[model samples]
Target: MKKQRPPGLIAIVAYKAFVASLLTVTSIALLFALKNHKILENFSESYLLETKLKIIELLLDKFLIVKPKTLLFSGLAAGFYAGLTAVEALGLWYQKGWATILVLVLVGISIPPEIYELFQGLTLLKLAVFIANLAVLWYLLHHLPKHGKAD
Candidate 1:
């Protein structure tokens, strides 16, 4: 008989999958923007005029200043991250030990940078992400010993 996965494990897998999807979309959008920079700028200008939201305006300003090479690099990086996240999700779904370690190490590595960013600017989004990663790390650490022989 096969062992059933715990709900927390399922939640972790789902969260990773969701993050992968978001990253995939972001990668695609950035790539598309790179290809159609002029069109995007025009569209954004019109959209900005219609909305006039300060946050959107600020984001658009930043977007407008980004060079094509930067866009390409960002797009590639996001795509690579998306791929990594998808792998993590798949490995966890199959209850692979390496996947757990991969997630732990990756999440662990990100913590210092996240804290630094928070110190730089304490935004709600940053706080939420930090909290989420911490929760995932805590859950994995607490549950790992019980699972045993991950390999």
Candidate 2:
């Protein structure tokens, strides 16, 4: 008989999968935006004029200045990250030992940068991400030994 996966592990897998899905969408959007830059710019301008929303104006202002090379790089990078995250999710779902280590190392390395970002400018989104990563790290560390014994 197969063992049931722990709820925490399931949650982690779900989280990774969700992140991968979001990144994939973002990657596609960026690439599309890059290809249709002029159309996007015209649409944004008309949308801004119609809505007159400060937030949209602010965001579009910054977005308009992005170079094509930067867009290409950002899209490619996001795609790569999405692929990596999907692999992590699948590996964890199958309870692969190397996946655990991969996650541990990736999450561990991110902590310092997260801290730096928080210190640079604290935000609710950043705080939540930092806490979530910490929780994942703690859960894996706590459960690793038991997980190994099961193998």
Candidate 3:
């Protein structure tokens, strides 16, 4: 059997998806680290009482109140999601097994909650990001090799 090249569209979409996932993972990790380090624990509110700084200080206070275990688990889940996305992208790019199909199913399951968020109030940025993700997932799933191993 001859190895086939993945479709150009699939390559582009998968690479974009890979980058998105990487960014998501990195952002989540950074948030976790910042919360864990308690670097904001001792900022003198009286000295740095500017409105913007106050708002951030208040937000960090709320964030720091969340349970550490919960934060850790959420961070781990985000990492797993990103790792799986990377795998999906690799599979799509290589025209390997059914990774694209798996990713589509995962995305399909995920969209309902996001759609509800959209219905509540959809920002242009949120809509664009969701649409781009859907488009990439669809393109890769659609262009997957017609014949391949069951795995």
Compared with the true structure, all predictions reach lDDT values of 0.89, 0.89, 0.66
Worst 10 residues of 1 by lDDT: 142-151
The 10-residue segment of model 2 with minimum total lDDT is 142-151
Candidates in descending TM-score order: 2, 1, 3
| lDDT (10s digit) by residue, model 1, range 1-151 | 9888989889889999999999999999999989998876886678555766777767777898999999999999999999999999998888888888889999999999999999999999999989989998999999886543547
Positional deviation of residue 21's Cα in model 2 after best superposition, in angstroms: 1.1
Query: For candidate 3, lDDT tens digit of each residue in 1-151?
Result: 9676646555554565766577577758756665754555555343574555777777767766766676666677767777777777677665556765776677778678778889999899679767866776676566656623567
* Residue 69 local lDDT, model 1: 95
Model 1 off-target regions past 4 Å? 41-60, 148-150
In the order shown, the candidates' Cα RMSDs to the true structure are 3.1, 2.5, 3.8
139: Cα error in model 3, Å: 2.6
TM per model? 0.84, 0.88, 0.69
